[model samples]
Target: MSDVRQLLTSLQFADSAFPSGFYTMSHGLEGYRQARLVSADGVQQLLADLLLHSVGPGDATALAAAHRAAADGDIELVQEVDQRLFASKLNAEMRTASVRSGHQLIDLGAELIDQGLLAEYGERVRLRSTPGCQPVAAAVVYAANGVATRQAVASDLFAFSASFVGAALRLRLTDHRQAQAILLQTSPVMEQVTEAALERNLTDLGGFAPMADVMSAQHERAEARLFAS
Candidate 1:
């Protein structure tokens, strides 16, 4: 029964249909497309790089930290993890995308999950005490819902892929079949990244995706865009 609950919670948080505002943000994929730097093959490469370099050491590591902290009833540490992750995001759109999605997730989770911790954290976010990045919000929800930390990180990373692929399909970068292939090929990379992310401490919560940051910054000033980031 506990296993079933965990699976359901993971699925709920990961589902694209969830009102986490995930569909509105492309997470820098739009910038790559506008720059003509992405083909179908490049889509796979970008996802792999993001999983390993950007998302793994940054958001996934923060999620693991927040999960452990929440488990130990340490909300202060969760805020610290969230702030560090926010500071590491070099692009404004990147930070906005994460904070927006995270705020929405916290709002929805607090209403649905009956978790006092989320409510308290939501207050902190309301007070601007924390940036309330997506990973931290995910960690809090997963911990409250009995999902394991590794699974929480994995789910967050997968949700990111789903959002990126959705953007690619809309941008006409890939067809449905090719998008499916991208997800299939990227699954192993996601697994490996998740493993590494789980072993990271809060001090290891930084990323080196210079190109992604540049692209994201460009996206912020684009004349037009299909996605927010």
Candidate 2:
């Protein structure tokens, strides 16, 4: 019964309609589209690359670390993880998008979960003591709600993939059917990434996708943009 409840909780948080502000960002797909770098056929590959080399090593790892820290009732360690993740982001746009969504998630987690830790963390975010990256905020919420560490990491990874594929749909790079296929095909990669993130040390947090960073930097200078990052 506890396992079932944890599954449901993970689903609720991972849902696209949860108002995490993920819809406002493209996860950097639009910038690639603008540069003519990706297409319908390449969408899955791009997502896989990101999971393997970027999001897995970076955000997902941070989520795993923060989740464990929160589970241990170590808010200071959680904040340290959050600060490290924020500093790892190379571009201002990526950092801004993360903090913007993070703030929203932390606020929602505080009200919805009604956990004192979340409330305390939210206050810290307000005071700018921590950047409140989305994954870390999610970590606190999931930990407080009894979601296991691995499940928490995997759920957030799926949410990120969904948001990425959703962005691909809006960019007209993929149809609805292809988008679903892309997500289905990426499951194995997600699983592998999740495992890696779970085992990753906080000192190793951050991704090395220089090209993605470059694309994001380019997107920042564009006169017109569809997604925030």
Candidate 3:
């Protein structure tokens, strides 16, 4: 029964309608589209590359570490993980988007989930003690709700993928059916990426995607923009 409840909690948080502010983010897909570097057919591969290279190594790893810290009641360690993740984000837009979404998640989690750790973490974020990146905030919420570390990491990854595909749909790079197919094709990559994230340590907290970083940096200065990194 407890396991079932945990699964439900994960689902609730992972839902695209849960208002984690992901709808406003293209996760850099719009930047790639604007640069003409990505096509409709290339959407799945681009998403897979991001999961394997960037999100998996960076954000996912931090989530796993933070989850462990939060589960162990080591708020300081969780803060350390959060700070490290924030510092690793290369561009200002990316950093701002993360912290923005994270703030929303932490605040909502505090009100809807557990008021204990979520409230404390929210206070820390308010105090500027931590940057409150989305993954770390998610780790705290999932841990507080008794969700396992692996499930939490995977759930967030899926949410990211969904957001990415949804962005592609809005950008006209792909239609609804194709977007679902892309997500289906990306499942194996998600599993592999999730495992790799679980095995990573705090020191391996950053991703190395030079092209994506370049695109994001360009997007930051574009005269016309539709998404916030």
Candidate 4:
């Protein structure tokens, strides 16, 4: 059996009901799908590319940073990564998605988490002094709650993919069974990416996912959009 603290960390971060606003944010996949860039027939590859080219190294680094910052009560790390989030997510839509989800996570944490750091971060972001990107906020949540750096990053990655899968499900890109099949097919890929993410050094955190950036930029001006990002 897992230790009490480990089980608590997993239970807290892994729960989809933690109010990360994950259900609403698509993380650029919605835009790509609507643009027909990610066809229903090719969702597996799309998911793979997203994990590899985007969240695997990019958000994982931020997540790791957040985890450590939370551990040491270093607010500067959170703020630095927030700036990185803006620099890395070139598109307005993607940036908006991150902040929105992060704000929601902090809000939910106030009720669920024993720590008050996330709640304070949410207030700062709402006041426009800080950028409340999801990766950073999620790291705080997991780290404060005793989740390991590796586990916290994994939670972020899983949550990222799960949100896109939810978006695909809502868009009718695939039925439940098909989505599950895609997730299963992608499960191994998630593990591999997590491994790569674990091996990654802290300094190598930036990424440029061009297609995702373009899609998000277009989505910002997309006249009839369903999801936020």
Candidate order by decreasing TM-score? 2, 3, 1, 4
Which ten-residue region of model 2 has the weakest summed lDDT? Answer: 108-117
lDDT of 2: 0.93
- Could you give candidate 1's per-residue lDDT for residues 1-229 as a string of tens digits? 2878887889988998988888998888999999988887789999999889998999999999999998787999989999999999988888998999999989888888788787888999999999999999989988988888888889888898998899899988899999989999999999999999988878888989999888998899999988989
C-alpha lDDT of all candidate models, in order: 0.89, 0.93, 0.93, 0.77
Q: Which sections of candidate 1 miss by over 4 Å? A: none
Which pairs clash (backbone N, Cα, C closer than 3 Å) in model 1? none
Best by lDDT: 2
Q: Write the per-residue lDDT of candidate 3 for residues 17-82, one digit (tens) a residue.
A: 989999999999989999999998899999999999999999999999999999998999999999
Per-residue alpha-carbon lDDT of model 4 for 1-229, expressed as tens digits? 2467776666666666656778777777778877888778877788888898788778877787767777888776777777776677777777787888877777777677677677666677788777888888788877667788777777677777777787888888888899888888888888888788777766777676888778888888888878888
Candidate 3 TM-score versus the reference: 0.98
Clashing pairs in 3: none
Instruction: Estimate the TM-score for candidate 2.
Output: 0.98
Clash list (residue pairs), candidate 2? none
Q: State every prediction's TM-score relative to the real structure.
A: 0.98, 0.98, 0.98, 0.89
Flag regions of model 3 displaced more than 4 Å.
none
Query: What's the residue-level lDDT of 131 in candidate 3?
Result: 92
